[model samples]
Target: MALFDDLFIRLTSRKVGRDRFGNTYWEARSRKDAYGRPLRRVTYAGVPEASAVPPEWWGWLHHTTDRPLPEDAPRRPWQKEHRPNMTGTREAWRPPGHDAAGGRRQPSPGDYEAWTPGR
Candidate 1:
């Protein structure tokens, strides 16, 4: 299981930094692809669930940051942190007209339609 061992080594190495969710990040010590051509790379450890990473970390992971999240990163006093989409979760929203809620109260009597599939 060298693949797993390599990942464990990379994740626990002192050169890597760990995020709040225990995700690890490390810069490629050398600028070269596996084929040995010059290239830049960053590696991530742990599940790739987007929700597991915070917004600031997400930006850094995508090369938007030359430096890791700063200690002084501005945050408004009233600002709330990002939460992942929960479309299928218990907390997910169900609009008033959705079938889950028995759909919009039946359309008014005058809204009746006679279907003519071909016409």
Candidate 2:
């Protein structure tokens, strides 16, 4: 959707943070709205894809956390970086035997046997 948002306004708004993908986060500098509630917003890097937002920033955007992830926090080996959803796109993954791969899984030898008559 097209919005008539003024570039000057965005330029002057409080610069919250920038994610790895270049997405810019913002919060009202005034800290509170007319109703005395906190204001937060995120300007996506591109195309405004929901999945494009990383988990850490997402938590802050959604008010799940009072602050974004600490920059100095050590990352665990088991933790993985976030990636946008790729479902239905060419980048999406398909298993080896999937119909899109033009192949079918072959049954392993001795995996099964037909029962004729008991010997």
Candidate 3:
């Protein structure tokens, strides 16, 4: 974090809320911009990766909603925790047969057949 931004955030922003994944959302202390339009910002908790921010907060950050989604909003029983982008990292997904994992694919003879025009 640069000195100016650190000072600005500390002086001019207030905590709106934090999501389940630990991302923090903020709003300008003085509501509305110089042109009298709404303004807001977000301070990513860790690596500053945008993908880590939840969908609801992403919407609010982009002004899709006036209210930031409640931090502890109820979730469906089937819901899974959000995962941040792992591209270029060892933790990234490597599907079966992926070159990074191995060049060999599981044999599935019945999975495909060349089309025959004259049956």
Write down the TM-score of every candidate.
Answer: 0.57, 0.64, 0.68
The candidate 2 region of ten consecutive residues with least summed lDDT is 1-10
Clashing pairs in 3: none
What candidate 1 gets wrong by more than 4 Å, as runs, is: 1-16, 31-47, 71-74, 105-115
Per-residue lDDT of 65-110 in model 1, one digit per residue for the tens? 7556853579989867756568788778887777776688756689
The residue ranges of model 2 lying beyond 4 angstroms of the native Cα positions read 1-3, 6-13, 29-36, 106-119
Pick the winner on TM-score between candidates 1 and 3: 3
Q: How accurate is candidate 2 locally (lDDT)?
A: 0.76
When sorted by lDDT, best at the front, the candidate numbers are 3, 2, 1
Score each candidate by Cα lDDT: 0.59, 0.76, 0.78
Model 3 C-alpha lDDT per residue in residues 19-85, reported as the tens digit of each score:
7666677888777967675567777667778788887787888887888777577988997778878
Q: Which runs of model 3 end up more than 4 angstroms from their true locations? A: 20-22, 29-37, 106-119
Best by TM-score: 3
| Winner on TM-score (2 vs 3) | 3
